[model samples]
Target chain A: MLAWAIPTYTPAYPGYGASPALMLNVSVYVMLFMAILSLIRISVAVYTNRPVCSEEREFPEDLEGDDGFTQVGRMNLLHLARVMIPCVLLVVAIEYIGYALASFAFLMILQYLIGSRKWLQSTILSSVLVAVLYIVMRYGFGVPVPGPQVF
Target chain B: MEMIFAGLLDSISPASLMFLLVGVAVGVLIGAIPGINGPMAIALFIPITYYMTPLTAIGFLVGLNKGAFFGGAVSAVLLRTPGTPEAAATSWDGYPLTQQGKGEKALRMALYSSVAGDIISTFVLILIAAPLAAVALFMGPSEIFALISLALTVIAGIGTTSICRGLIAAGFGIAAGLIGTEPVTALPRMTFDVYQLGSGLSLIPVAIGLLAFSEILLQLERFTVKGDSEHSANVFSSKLEDRLVSFKEFFSKLKTLLRGSLIGIGVGAMPGLGAPVASFMSYDQAMKRSKNKNEFGKGSLEGIAASESANSSVVASSLIPLFVLGIPGNLAAAMLMGAFMIHGMQPGPLLFKENAQLMYGIYGSLVLASLFLLLIGRFGLRLFCKAVDIPAMVLYPIVIFTCIMGAYLGKSSMFDVGVMLTFGFIGYFMRKFDYSYVAFLIGFILAPEWERALQQVVIISENNTFMFFQRPVAMVLMAVTFFVIGRTFWVSINDSRRKKAEQAMSAEQAKNG
Candidate 1:
């Protein structure tokens, strides 16, 4: 009686078996379910609400988000490019310096980029922090911390 | 009592004090940074603490965890961007104050609240836990399970949103916990034979991806969006003295503070739920109980105070279950347990007998840590204020990089690092679409435990589904569960209607105007 019958198998790729659904009550209940539910609720609201059709209506200019909560401007193309290039390069270079070295360099640079004028203060604090971590890792945990080679 | 005095004396030593102060400072900084969190900070420090005496190491990590809770507020107040998920509630009201040229005052309130609440709760934790643990020594798994159920019930009551969504979130959390090797059976649930999946997803990477990397992606859309600080961010003279509210006005709000504290402790003591829930629940309660509900989200100091104190107090409350029952209240406490274990101290019933002095040391250290939090957060306010100045152009990449680095630290594997970044990008999309990143975090952190618990239940129940309903405690918990779900759905429905009405009224008014 059914003209359009569905196939049972979607077929699996090599090294795979009959694929279970992407959700198996396992993935659905943990976190993805909440997201799905919220998305549905919010989306229905957004879709059903009609535009007011008022020219003066706009997002409040004074609204804030917190790291400091003041309104932050969008980055110019140049500024965005400036950060993106170095970020990509840093990913490639991250392994060569070892974790501690990479952290020290990265944090110092970040402090500057964030407009910290207390270079000496940051350097001293960073040095102390790294030193404390170094001692802890080497002596406390006995991990052979990768110090810069003497050679 | 003898051991307690000795432990206090030991912790008061110069070495211990140094470790405690440094730990709190380190905790705040690590917690303040986007993506990094309390648990990961503790884990990272655990290895480094091996050489130190357990007193120093434990002292330091405890102080550090406490410190991180407050640190996130600095980033939350200035940027309107919470540095940690716990600070998200703080941002709702805290950020509004910043826009009103009251950033300094807002930050000060958060600082004082975090310190005061944390100190008060530590004393409460000490007084309550010792006696409770002693009493609970005779308890069996049946009682433990019941307690956990009650705790979860309390936690489930936190969110004011749709009850279905909250239950769905908790169910998802339970299901997420039900993965990997079954503890009772040692059989894999759905590992697919992968080595990494065998251990399951770690909380640190998940938090970094969800809170930090995801935020970076969201911010990327408006990477160039900049707003000047309020016309007078430097308008310091009158408000500098905290003249916005009279002293008589401040004393009158004590009732709200106490009520929020009660809600915070109740939500916090329950496992799985953590600071964010406590803060939000407290904030919600404050609004409901207030003579002026609209004052919330409108630069109300009481709103800020309630949320901030509730979150910080939850930190101490979280330790109650940890110290008494050996069940961690949340991810951060779980990692702290791991650190304690690595130090040759298993924190459970035996822990009280074998290491009573050490227990007292922890109690003493928590008090000291809260004191330091108050001292540092107040005096260091000006330094933290500068955080408000960082441009999104520079800050976003740094946050993203920190997340990547944090993920790499987890396994020292570039593979895991890539996994962190992948999740970060996905997490970004999740946030844009109003996804429950908190659910994801709960899932990742509790996956192994949830798996173990379900397997235990399945085996104990002999696959008899009715067993879950058979126990009186479980029955009560289930009843409460249903009530919560029904209430939440009802509220959400009402909320949607109310919002619709407001929008229609606004539209009509606009047309007339």
Candidate 2:
């Protein structure tokens, strides 16, 4: 988590006139309190032999027989990894390849991973969605979609 | 009076009216789809509204909120799934009604009650917002801090079954909010010297990550595990006349509708207590008073009316706090506040005084939205019902694309996208752990304001924080805060004890058998 932080600091901002450490101190105290409370909660859960987190066992009984997709199913670790890895890579790749190509690639890859039966249909849909979004952002809303600057 | 008339005309103008219709249509479509909610939709649309006039933008968003409330009920009735958390109570009677082939009746009841409740609450907001804002103007910084503290405590208590977990989430949220430069000194506190962190996390990224992206991740798990039961074919049979509800039958439950509206309006006006609480509470009350209580979880129209009315009414009445005190009552209102600030309008006492015309314009928009909700809902009910059949596999990937687009568009920074993804993971964990994300969100939204108010109090009292005790309003608010926390703790303890006892009894029964 600390790796996300920048290493250096400078007191260069214009408004740092009398330090308002009071608010900062209070916020830190609240965080400490929360940390302590979380410890206590875990301790209680262990002592009671109850699960620390509610187990996702099945869909709610009311939705038991529905034909439509249910959001809660068994945790698919492999499927999750397959989706998450590429998503993270896509975020990184966007900086180099730009949003248009990165988005199109991300969607196509994700659709295949999620088990899209028709590769041609997935490709066309991904292209159409990406084009529509790019046109709307670049032309309709005037937001600049990054082009291939590095590549 | 003249300004009010002008504002009314402005709201009803062709362009504004068109946006309102669009907002309602979009909101209803999104809301009918499971796992997508109003807050996520609103957050996603915030950037789009950057080019819109303030009145049209606000009118459109407000219409979206109103339409989503009723749209959620469509899935609850036909698909036995809640499109939003607030619609969970609707499923108690709604799904059963569908099984009994009265899905259309249930949907119509939900629609009428939602609109009736929403219109009444809008009237309440219009009538009370100005006077409330006037009263809020008199509060000192100390008084305001105490009031916020009380609101946080109440919210923490009512938001979750476990008050301790709720407070923990809120505390973490406050810490998260305080990560940027300190408000008074402008000195970096916990930014770790990151330039992006210096501005604090943008509300858009955090909101989208928590509400939208996290949901997609959670829903993705469904792909791997197939259900045991064979999928029931023809969830909604095409015999339309069998399900149509008559006006006379709906009118028979007018008393339940009014009761639910009152409960909704009351809960919505209070910060932290939101639509779910109001809907469940009203459902419980209606069940207790019902002549045919046995029919409650088995397709009672009155039960559907009770839950839908109460939840829908909250859409309008929750804006009361935001309009009067510049403090958002819930996540949806917080998003609305962001829209207001983006349009260069601050929401408090001065807003009513300086922007009376705009306030009246907003009120006019609400009235127009209610009428639009009725028309669109009546004509487009089948379309929304069909929306439920959309597969999660296709829908969620598209939603993810939108989420990313929204995060990037907010500040046009990749750092914001990273922030959104990180928070999405955090939100997923929070949900699994039974932590109240709503409390966390409210805490994050209020932290900056709370700190600023506390600083003002310290400066005004010359650093004598004890002076808070001397202020009658401040003292009263503090006392209320303490009382609420204490009561919540007591209730939580008793609940735990009861659960333990039940567990022990079940063990003994199994041994005897």
How well does chain A score by TM in each candidate?
0.46, 0.60
lDDT of 1 at B452: 38
Q: Pairing residues by index, what is the TM-score of model 2?
A: 0.90
Task: Give the per-residue Cα lDDT of candidate 2 at B460.
Answer: 75
| DockQ class, candidate 2 | acceptable
lDDT of 2 by residue, B346-431 (tens): 77677888888888999999998989998998998878887877766567678888888888887877788888888887876676
Candidate 1 lDDT over residue span A1-151, tens digit each: 0111101211122222212222224445434555576567556645765431211211233234421112323443344344344544455555576646665675566555544567786676556555765564455555544324322
lDDT of 1 by residue, B138-236 (tens): 654444554554444344433323344444544544544444444543445455555675655554455555555555554554433443232124323
Clashing pairs in 2: none
Q: Which runs of model 1 end up more than 4 angstroms from their true locations?
A: A1-151, B13-15, B27-58, B72-113, B134-180, B184-189, B216-267, B270-311, B321-355, B387-402, B457-470, B501-513
List the candidate 2 regions with Cα displacement exceeding 4 Å: A1-19, A38-80, A147-151, B158-160, B225-241
Instruction: Tell me the native contact fraction for each prediction.
Output: 0.10, 0.32
Error of 1 at A109 (Å): 12
